[model samples]
Target chain A: MAEVDEASKPLLRDLKAVGKKFGHVMYPKKSTTLLRDWDLWGPLLLCVTLALMLQGGSADSKEDGGPQFAEVFVIIWFGSVIITLNSKLLGGTISFFQSLCVLGYCILPLTVAMIVCRLVLLGGTGTASFIVRFIVVVASFGWSTFASTAFLADSQPPNRKALVVYPVFLFYFVISWMIVTFSPSHSDGTTDTGP
Target chain B: MSTTERNKNPNSTESWGGFEDNPIQGGGSAVIDMENMDDTSGSSFEDMGDMHQRIKEEEEVSEEAAATEEGDDGEFLGMKGVKGQLGRQVADEVWQAGKRQASKAFNLYGNIDILRPYFDVEPIQVRNRLLESLIPVRIINFPQKIAGELYGPLMLVFTLVAILLHGMKTSGTVIREGTLMGTAIGTCFGYWLGISSFIYFLAYLCNAQITMLQILSLLGYGLFGHCVVLFVTYTVHFHSLFYILWLVVGGLSTLRMVAALISRTVGHTPRLILCATLSALHMLFLLYLHFAYHKIVEGILDTLEGPNVPPFQRIARDIPEVSVALVNTTVKTISATLQSY
Candidate 1:
């Protein structure tokens, strides 16, 4: 009982410290605090929100063969894990969870772009709507890539930084491609595939 | 002394002393004297008189001090009473403080000289900054205060002129249909104010410490891009390239300004989200104008003519077949696996 009590005291203190760190992450600045004391809840919450956005976009899509909910969640989870592993293999100083956190939060812009593209599709499928969706997806893709790189890029070795960034770039590009291609499912089984 | 002797003597002070000396013999007269006396005793009455005199002197001194105080400060001269003066002074101080805050809110509009390059020259640097602002990064030193102020008014004038010109081009007459011109101008201004106010509300929700003037100025500068488009269209042919260029410039400038303003308050995630949403709205506005004002209807007809590929799709279609097949295969496999669940 005494040993457990002694252990619980330090654990409680550590939890309190982590709680404060989480507060800082909620209103993140260009500071190192988020990277210093990484937490799971922040990234998990963000991933769930991203998943919800993906699901919402799919639900509104005109195509019948869009990715399901589980597919999106799996893709995001596996994508983050793959990127984190790649980042580690490249001798990046950041840990697996920290990389995951950064990558997951970075998905925010693309998720927002997806929701917006879906909404724009609702108005009409004119060339103007396509242009609007294109601009949004491109801008958000760039933003997501930039935001993630701002945190993860510095952790990489100086010489191999470009190599590390390639994966990150490709990661966001794939997501943007998916968002751009997503369309609402029709009542019939036929899908309206974009060129 | 007897009561009658005291009354007849007419020397009341000496008689009172005599009565006090022979208390037993003049007991009845002393009782009557006590009854006629004032409620207060002699020593107490003297003390009360001294206190009243001191209080009157203090009042006069305070009045002099207040008058001198009011003289020292010219702002309180109009007030008649001391209380009125003090009250007015407090109110004046509050009013001055409020004025200082109001001035701070409008401080961006003060120095117009910094924007001289925009008017006198091409303002290449400012234009470059406008493009750079779209990057959603922290800019340590933006010459937004002065340049933005000048941009707002200039943009407003350009917008008005553009609307008038568009009216002239469309209706074939400006002076004949005065009400139409007036309505168009009113609609333009109303839309400008409405969109600016909406952006301000979004900034507020983000807890960004941005002033209304800053937002209005940024949006005004954005309108300057549209004015360029209008001028080009009016003078030359309505080319899609120029229209697209306007969209790029205006959209980027507005996006950069918004991102810069809210970068400090919101995190990177929310900031990018807001930027995307706002930029999307800007594109929608451009599309609306393209259809409403230009009446080109090319995009609409494209949509109607078979299953037309969107511009984005056309660009996507240019990618190598291998990468496209790879992405499709990966997505299909993953989705196929998840379908069982």
Candidate 2:
């Protein structure tokens, strides 16, 4: 009985860690959660899921076009890596992963939008579905940009806040494009912002 | 963290939250020990030092728990990453040298010791895993990694590619071989891995917990449907056939992919979401197949139309002659029936 109790402790600890991270994501009012004891697990997961959802024409050969998970995976990771480099080069105060954590975790709203879009698409995907999807994606795009910049704004050097925010905007915009154009060939969860 | 999961059965996918942990936590077996965790690993930064200390600590805890004798020996053999990294190279070499002998003495299966981790209650069924993966009928049963096979999907993919290449060659399509191979392999494998990873991501989203390989096996089998579409183009060659085939293959695979995922889904909305997504995947795959290879039907017709002979004339030449008496008797019977009417 004692051994069984001891065996299960690690599992309980892991649950607590995930719950705490989720709390921080749900309420982006603090940076200490992601800033101080940074771990890539949350970011990596959100990145993979978002990449999978946004899988578009990037992976296809020239003729039979569509994005591959590899392309989305590379784009998201490399995109963030480049942004991290830019921030650090400009003498940002935060570590690379902390800034990355901010960018990655803020994608939660967009990810949820993807899920909702997928569900809305279940009814039909004509002009109406496109409109619904556009609103949701626009809202998510706004939310992601705002949240990431909110967290990362302090990390930038005083004069170069635009420089940091600009790249962050581009990064999220690229992700949003992937989300908007996603057709769910596996039935994408997000809606088409345009026809 | 993943080491335990690597040993863990698919049954444990329900609570996948703890997966993707700090990879530092190997030798997960010795984690059962409660005491001496601090004294051994307190100074060391490496996870191996923690495991080595935990294994030593297990000896004291063994008096009460008494089940981890094999767990200690299996660590050296399993966590190969730790091979040369430990502080004492000479002692590590000695430990390496004794691994096989140690495994034989302590593990349940002796030399076949890797099996100890999986500890199956039911027998390993390779045939079931293979057949089910192709059609995805028995989804309630979690796919056992030990029993999973890639040969079926791999072969079907190869055959479909080969058939498409052959069709293009015979039809005088002038695409370069390199480009053809690149496109075929890319679409085949890209779509396979892409869609599987997508479903995996979806399952993760809905908390439907599944192993990566299980999802791979489930989606890999859809290649069989692609092969079916290609095979029918030969004898019954027609450009319009794909429309009907899409309905048949897409609907069936949708049902199968959904049923397979059913056992793992968390609830109603997820079920509906998965059903829509899976059916949509099937629809896309069928359409992709048609785009890539529907020309094969026309190609087959082109081959059959050899040198001024339409297919009807060529086939007509193959018919054996009919007797005049038989023709006359059939005409007389038809005339009598018309008179009676």
Candidate 3:
């Protein structure tokens, strides 16, 4: 009984520490402790939820069809891998897991944007819908790109920054394109959708 | 005889009648004699050797007298000497204690070290890191420092300046209209104070160890993005792209600060809720500003010159659809040519 009690004390302390780590994500300042002692749980959870959200938002669209859950996952996973590899090839020193963590967390703004898009779609379609969708996509893309680069940019050799940033730009452009083209089909079938 | 001469010569006590023989009278006369002896000190140096011998004998006699006095009233004599020393020591202690208390109070205002990053961080880096929401360690450490008291006031000053600049840019008549300027300032301060206090109260209820000043500073820091936006708008005139860029950058900056605060105090779920709530409030505040501007202008002009649409709504009109169309066409051309195969 005494041994069990002693074991549980450290366990409780660890649990508390984990909780604190999760909270630190919201902090504006980068916590070196968090960077040093990274975990996969939070990033994994966020990626899943974000993918689900993006899928759910596009699910109702008949034109160009919504992305499947697996497709969303593949896009994020593959994109992260490509970006991570590209950075490493360019003499960047960030570990694979750390790169993945940064990339995954960067999806948060896009996730929020998608959720907002979903709500906006519920209101109507046409110029207003396109406008809101366009703004949200652009904003989220900018945010994700900026966020990812902020973490990854410093790792690359100074002379090769543009080379490293090019892939990031393309990555965000593709995401933005997907978001912009995500048009929910109207039952009325008015094909003349104003740009 | 002077008290010093009397103290030097052991026989002087016998001539003057010993303090033991008449303690009250002897004590009174001893004080009087000491006062008179102050003027005769130069003349007394002539018999220094003789006086030294007498002083040694007097010390022996006084030591014996003190020993006897200890038996009769030792506690009283000891206490008298102690009281004199204790008064000086107590006063010294009290002065030191007050200084410590004042320093503790002054610390609530904030520390200069927290502002170091703002100066040390390169401008380009600030723009990049701020937009990405990747806050540096120093920026994070700023709020955690005990010296965060200055954050609120600094934020206020920056925000007020931004608002004034925004007013100048938006309205030609604003510079001349005292009432308008006053109203704008009042509204800005009122909103900031109200929102900061509300958040502070909510944080308090959540059992977070955040101070009112910290919350105020956080909110104030969030406005910095807007300050930049206003500056750009004032200088360059309105450009949709620049506006959106600044908006995102500002939003991220604010979000980062709020996240930092929430992470320290609340649980994960509560932190998310609080963050979302704060973000929504910020969006709402922006919306309110848009409408409020129109109302103020309409009231002043008595007729709306143009529809005061939210700047975000202009995004649709401003979007470069031509580029999007070209991209779409290129994709279609490639896909269709491949399908022909």
Where is the poorest 10-residue window by lDDT in model 3 chain B? B294-303
The lDDT per prediction is 0.54, 0.56, 0.53
Instruction: Judge candidate 2 at residue B97 and give its lDDT.
Output: 76
Q: Tell me the tens digit of each residue's lDDT in model 2 across B56-159.
A: 44333443333444565446443442343343467768988799668766553223334322222111232344345445465555632322334344444545
Q: Which residue ranges in model 2 land beyond 4 Å of their true spot? A: A1-5, A55-64, A185-195, B1-341
Model 2: CAPRI class = incorrect
Q: By the lDDT metric, which is better: model 1 or model 3? A: 1
Task: List the lowest-lDDT window of 10 residues for candidate 1 chain A.
Answer: A186-195
Docking quality category of candidate 3 according to DockQ thresholds: incorrect
Q: What class would a CAPRI assessor give candidate 1's docking? A: incorrect
The Cα error of candidate 2 at residue B109, in Å, is 49
- Candidate 1 per-residue lDDT, tens place, B1-341, comes to 22333345443323233222223333233333333222222223334554455434433443444454534342232222235546668998999999998897556334333443333323354455444444444452442342444333333443444344342323122233233324445556665677779877877777766677666666665665555555454333335554576667656666565556654455666566656666666666555443344412232233356334332111122223544464578799999999978
TM-score of chain A of 1: 0.74
TM-scores (chain A) of the candidates: 0.74, 0.83, 0.75
Off by over 4 Å in 1: A1-30, A57-63, A185-195, B1-304, B308-341
lDDT of 1 by residue, A1-195 (tens): 999999899878766765555444334457676577666665566567666665664475433334456655665676687667655654568877788877776776777788788788789766577778888989888888877777777787776666566567766765675566554533221111222
* The best candidate in terms of TM-score: 2
